[model samples]
Target: MSDAQTQKVLDHIDADFDNSLQRLFALLRIKSISADPAFAGDCKAAADHLAGDIASLGFDARVRPTAGHPAVVAKSNGKGNGGGARPHVLFYGHYDVQPVDPLNLWHRPPFEPVVTDHADGRKIIVARGAEDDKGQLMTFIEACRAWKSATGSLPLDITFLIEGEEEVGSKNFAPFLAANKDELKADYALVCDTGMWDPNTPAITTSLRGLVYDEVRIKAARRDLHSGLFGGAARNPIRVLTYILGGLFDENGHITIPGFYDGVKDLPPDILAQWKKLNLTPETFLKPVGLSIPAGEKGRLLIEQVSSRPTCSINGIVGGYTGEGSKTVIPAEASAKISFRLVEGQDPAKIRKAFRDYVTARIPGDCKVEFGDHSMAPAIALPWDMKALSAAKKALTEEWGREAVLFGSGGSIPVVADFKKTLGLESLLVGFGLDDDNIHSPNEKYDLKSFHKGIRSWARILAELAALPR
Candidate 1:
């Protein structure tokens, strides 16, 4: 691709930005809340609307049915330069928004998107799905539209996969992917569901922590007992549960489970050096949360503690309680929900087994223990030297006039793992969201600049990817 052609696409994006915002507003107006059964029609409407919009760009777009809300699949004509294959990418996004609960808190209707001035003087587009995904996804679509209008063709083969069940756990989406794996094949996947380092800085999420959510129930007695009558003789399940949980971590904040770190590896020297320069301190990362200490494994960077290192957290615990400040009873059963944030090289199943074994070994002889599984997913880490990653990073850096930060996120996006496992494709995660976007909350907004510049960024990325050797 010629630089002149790329410049034309970027120029078109700048000129047509108003129309881009309008299109995003049209999408944001659809109350496609996947979690509520009452909004099922809205979800289908979103799918159909997106399919038609994408089809306007000459793609073979169609709304396909899933077990739940439908999915939009659109593919380019696949005519490569000189009849040779080019890099093909499957762009992924969601059309669903979280339920707008507590409607009284919103300044305007959650479905009514508008461009407004932020308190910080930045132009923001406020709506329920503004930043979470509607705005973010439209950035890529608008970029494609610009390229198509400017050059009459896309720079490479493309497939669009927009789903409507992300907010809900995507339970059926995975099966949809499995059933259509052949038709959805691509060289790589592009996901816009993440955030940048900061409003001024660009970022590519190179790693995502996996999850192991489990619940443990301990029962020491069949019936509740009075504290006064059995306080000394009865084996309290709550006491047993807390005692075992207390030993799972050491003073240094490292998990004490055996073989928990079997496959864990340290970051590369170059990446570590870059992270050191970023200088993520507790004051900047934790102070806002009313915390002042780095509470992960000792001797690790605060960034590493949250992103790269594996961790175990007790999400919730419930046990015997006194009601009305009068009744004191040792409940027959006590339960706790625990979760583990895993990193690359750590297996979720093994971690889950190790944790269960650790708790089982420490249980009192008379107490009975039962474990319930909630969710488990392995961690994902992209190769540091991936060519597409380098290309996209260069494009973002140019767009933002600052070096893009390749960072690891502490949370998980299961679809990225599914792309690798099911389609044999790695994902390149890039987005223009800020830390305070208030996604999944009231009054969610997307920066107007992020919307416009994000289109320009993707246009440049497409050009850079096309220039690579086929």
Candidate 2:
């Protein structure tokens, strides 16, 4: 665990990186698109292949069945190096890539992995799941490989929990975790599905927003009524539905639900000051997405609005309509799908109840409202001073030659919360993905540097983590 020892492992990583790329390419070639039933065999193949590969590195690895795609669970105890005293860590990632729809947009076949030069002259590995997960996950696996080859064992006990259903909402993954809870115990988890701050700056995601999704239907009449006859007398469900949803946010963009923001709190002053230095602006973060304004709470910084604030969004709405042209009719029912992104300290159940209450309060007595619960998950917030977090920051800084940044992600990784719920484990979210990786899009690529140096970074991180006092 000394610096010289870490450097030796890093040197081994550098020397064997070409073989690492070849290994990643082999995994990418399996076409493990978990969402498409046509690729079910490929998903199994990817699981078998990855499990076999991990098992070769002195792990007790297997492809375990789930309700959906099978998951790979691999375990190692450093071959007696720990003697049960080393801190146990779990590493999580996914093997399944998004489907290659609109395949013509890709310059090359989506399944054909290749090393190519970007327009900016940087080398990239282009393939499905390149930067999204497969490539990023391999960085850690290769690091372990390097350490095993160099020192004949890893620095700490490790477990790998790679799944095939992440891109498909991980519906079966939580159940799998519950069933295998006793076998997957760990002090903490390391997830490799997020992005760095920028191409050159590493980052640790310390918080993730939770989610509540609901579908509501407003039924005003027993049957569709002709608007020509019911225009003034009968109630129009679409009109009623739109009116309620339109008022969900005030002019200043704060959600108008009662008690919605009751538990929300501002970031600490020190963290706020650091974020101010980040200077995230509309031109920098929004312009590329064809936007010029921050649309959350008016007074908060753009960074806070997007990454730290809770938000409500109307994902879709539908009512009576015409196939080819407008029909003069008052729809019997209108439905809307809504979701809320929740931050730490906010209870998803409470927020969902508040939203339902708000909607029900405005429902006319003549109209019947039916609610359909879709999904709900609580937010995740890691301690700012966790020992593993500090070790990861140091490891990344040493490998990247820049201070590692920490930030809150507006999005939710439900598995992170599931780990906490099922195994009493917190997760450290880290990765080498960049902003332009185009994951879930055509021509997805991982920076060659992200692959090579990412391996070295993990090698250093494992060493640093092992040296921490128990």
Candidate 3:
């Protein structure tokens, strides 16, 4: 774990990354799309390949079956210099890639991997799962390989619990963890699905917003009506739905839901000052999206607008209408898909109820309302006082040659909360995904630099974690 020993491993990483890229290419070519049943065998192949690759580094590795695809688990003792003491780290990543749709957008077959230059002159490796997972997961494994090759053994207790079903919402991962709680238990979990703040700025994701996805349908007049016959007498459910959704946010762009802010607290002054130093503003955040407004709670910073405040959004809506030009028809029903980004301590069930109640209260007599469930998960804000995080921050800073910035991302992993609840483990998210990775999109790519540096970064992290005074 000393600098001299760490240097030898790092040098090995720099020398061996070409081989790492080849390994990752092999993985990326596997077509492990877990959401579709047609790719089941491919998912199993990816799992087995990863398990076998991991076994080559001397861990006890296996590809175990779940109700879904399968999960790869590998374990090694974290005995520093044979001291028999250190933190046991459980690393999590997904081996499956998102389904590649709109295939026409890709320059090559989505499963055919190649390193090509981006339009901007940067070298990027293209494939379906390059950045989403295969690349990200292999960074960690390659780091371990370097450590094993250079130092003869790993520096700390480590286990890899990579699964094939993350693209499908980890439907079977929780049950798998619950079933094998004892074997998978570890001191901390390391997740590589998030990203850096920017290419040069290292980031540690501190908070992830929760989600409540709901669909509401309103029935009126029981059947489609002719506008000429029922124009003024009957209420148009589409109009009513618009008013209801439009009212969720008001003049200053705050959610009008009662008690929405009940659990929200302002950031501390020191943190606010730090955020100010980062210079994250509406212009920088919005310009890329073709917007320039702080469309959330008034007086709060743009960072808070995204990371802290609860938000309401209508994802989609539909009602009866003509397919072509003019069919003046009144719809029997109108429906909209609504989702809320929840903050820490906001109960998903309570928010879901409050939303339904708001709709019910606003509905007129003789109108029937029904709801459909999409998904729900509460926000997660990891504890900062842990020694592992402290060491990790320092090590990442050393690797990037700059201070690592802790951030509050506006998305949720869902499985992080599940890991904590089911295995009593805390997770540290460190990743190399950038805003332009085009994850879950056609022509997805992972920067060659991200892949190379990501492996070296994990090398530094592993050595630094081994040095922690446990």
Candidate 4:
């Protein structure tokens, strides 16, 4: 594939973009909310619609049943050049979307897809799943359509594994992958479920923080006691719980757990320097959230603290009770939900154990501490020198005329780990979403330019991947 051919495909994308938007509209109109059982048929409809649409592009596509919702698997018929093996990629996205609650907050009907002007004068496609997996995934599908339409076949072999349950934690998709591992084999996987750094800047997510969620309950007295009666003699569980949690961090803002940083490592000097150039400051990143302090590991850059470093947070705590005025009673038990954002080299199970141990060690002789596990997933860090990552970065730079930022995201996408674990494939994460796209919220939208250029970016990426050495 030559540069001329790539340009021809990009040209085809520009000419057919309106039809592309219409196709995305068709998808956005479906109310495929996976979290609700009432929308199960809609999820099936979404899977069937995508499979049939993708199959028209010379791919063997089908809607296969999973434990919950169905998943669409599409394989391109294109063989490598001269009938040799070509670089194969498994493209992953989700067709299911978050449920639209608080319907009155929406300016328009949630499923009635429409192009509207944003307050900033940007043209946006407004609907559920707009910047989410639906609009984002269509960029690649349309890119493939352009390639087949312009060049008679794709530049490489491609397989699409679009699922309908990502919004609901993808509990069954991992088993589905394990069950169909052979058919999903690929050199690597391509995921378009992340966001760019800003509207103008493209990004390739290089790492994702893992998660460990736990709940701890502290019980002192067998029953609630009058504050006057137990003020001096009784052990208050709320006070004990807060004190234990408060000590989890030290004066330097580092986690105080004995082995919390055991396996944690620092970012390479070169990457740290690159992050410095990004200039993620409190004014820009934190001010909007009514915060101005870099609260984690004080010496690290704001970007590093949020994206690359590990941290803990107490999500919720409940203990005493108060009515309209006040209740003069000490609660019998106090419980709190705590979560840790873990980095690479940090095991989720180890972190969970350390946290629980730390809390249990501080309990008084008469008090009891019980723990409950919620969820755990390990961090994912892609090899910095991966050829596919390099190829995709170069292609994105060419498409956007800006160097794509390779940054770690503070959030976790559990399926990325599953891809590596079940299918033995590293993932290349690229996406066209922006921070203010309002994804999973009322009036969710995707910028028209993101939808348009995202197609061009994927087109270039496909060409770049095909040209990589076998």
Q: lDDT of each prediction vs. the true structure?
A: 0.92, 0.91, 0.86, 0.93
lDDT (10s digit) by residue, model 1, range 1-470: 89899999999998898999999999999999999999999999999999999999999898999999999999886331123478788899999999998899999999999999999899999999999899999999999999999999999888999999999988988899999998888778999999889889999999999999999999988899999999999999989999999998999998999999999999999999999999899999999999998888899999999889999999999987745666788889999999999999999999999999999889877799999979988899999999999999999999999999999999999999998889888999999999999998999999999999999999999998887775
What is the lDDT, from 0 to 100, of the residue 263 in candidate 4? 88
Residue 447 in candidate 3, Cα distance off native in Å: 1.0
Clashes of each: 0, 0, 2, 0
Better model by TM-score: candidate 3 vs candidate 4: 4
Q: Identify the candidate with maximal lDDT.
A: 4
Ordered by lDDT, highest first, the candidates read: 4, 1, 2, 3
Tens digits of per-residue lDDT for model 4 on 385-433? 8999999999999989999999999999999999988888899999999
Question: What is the Cα root-mean-square deviation between model 3 and the actual structure?
Answer: 2.3
For model 3, the local distance difference test gives 0.86
For model 2, give the 10-residue run with minimal summed lDDT. Answer: 77-86
Tell me the spans in candidate 4 whose CA falls farther than 4 Å from its real position. 78-84
- List residue ranges in candidate 3 displaced over 4 A: 78-84
Q: Where is model 1 more than 4 Å wrong at Cα?
A: 78-84
Estimated TM-score for each candidate:
0.98, 0.97, 0.96, 0.98
Candidate 2 off by > 4 Å = 78-83
lDDT (Cα, 0-100) at 382 in candidate 4: 90
Model 4 C-alpha lDDT versus the unseen true structure: 0.93
Looking at model 3, the pairs that clash are 78-156, 78-157
